[model samples]
Target: MEVYLVRHTETVCEKGICYGQSDVPIAAPYLEIFESIKKQLPQDAIVYSSPLVRCSQLASYLSNTIIKDDRLMEMNFGNWEMKNWDAISPDEFTPWMNDFVNVSVPNGESFVELYNRVNDFLENDFQHNTSKAVVIVAHAGVIRSILCKISGLPLKDAFNNKVGFGAVIKIVL
Candidate 1:
């Protein structure tokens, strides 16, 4: 099976802000970027996207039929959503930074939780249809989790996979 993982274009949030699962809008002038991304994908492939507006906007532009999945959403930052990273007290942020894979945010999920849900989506929703190509429009975390699962990379090292905004990666499963 061929899978195309596409990260949404840049969001309106500033660099220091944590907008995880906040339903932020994409930056302006995204049509051109969407066009570029579309050129790299198969128009006939089944398309799935995060329910977030950022991913949904791009996915809709690429395909008329888009399946929105919550599993494709980014990590839920809970209380940290929309807050500047620096503003999060070191006391709370340091622990998560030290072991994000295992540490959950105040009211949010740990990276492992996100990975588990993403894995479930793959096993239950994706794996059954292996004959056709799949296009997944999602967040960086979701894309990284899929990459880690396919490559047998440890979840802790998922950051090593640099998923830039609007980046499209193709993988054969």
Candidate 2:
């Protein structure tokens, strides 16, 4: 199976803000980026997207028959959503920064929890459709989770993958 993992384009949020799973809008002038991303994917690929507007908009542009899945959503930042990184209390943030894979946010999930969600989607929804190419439009975290799963990278080292905004990565499974 050919999987095209695409991160949504930049969001309207300013830098330093954490908007995980917040349904933030994409930045302006995104049509051109979407077009470019579309061209890199298989034309007949099955399209899947996170329910967030950022991913949904790009997925809709790529294909009419889009399947929105909650599992594809970004990591849940809980109380940290929409807050500046510096604004979060260091006591709370430091622990997560030190061990994000195991430490769950105040009301959000841990990296390992997010990894499990992505794994469930791949095991239940994706693996069954291995005959056709798949285009997954999602957030950077979701894309990274998929990449980590396929590459067998440790969850703690997931950030090493460097999934840039609007980047499209193809992998054979």
Candidate 2 lDDT over residue span 1-173, tens digit each: 88899999999999999999898999999899989998899888899999999999999999999999999999999999999999999999999999999999999999999999999998888745567799999988888888888899998999999999999999888
Which 10 consecutive residues of model 2 have the lowest summed lDDT?
123-132
- The runs of at least 3 residues in candidate 2 whose Cα sits more than 4 Å from the true structure, single-residue gaps closed, are none
- Candidate 2 TM-score, true structure as reference: 0.97
- CA lDDT scores, all candidates in order: 0.95, 0.92
TM-score of each: 0.98, 0.97
lDDT for model 1 comes to 0.95
- Inter-residue clash pairs, candidate 2: none
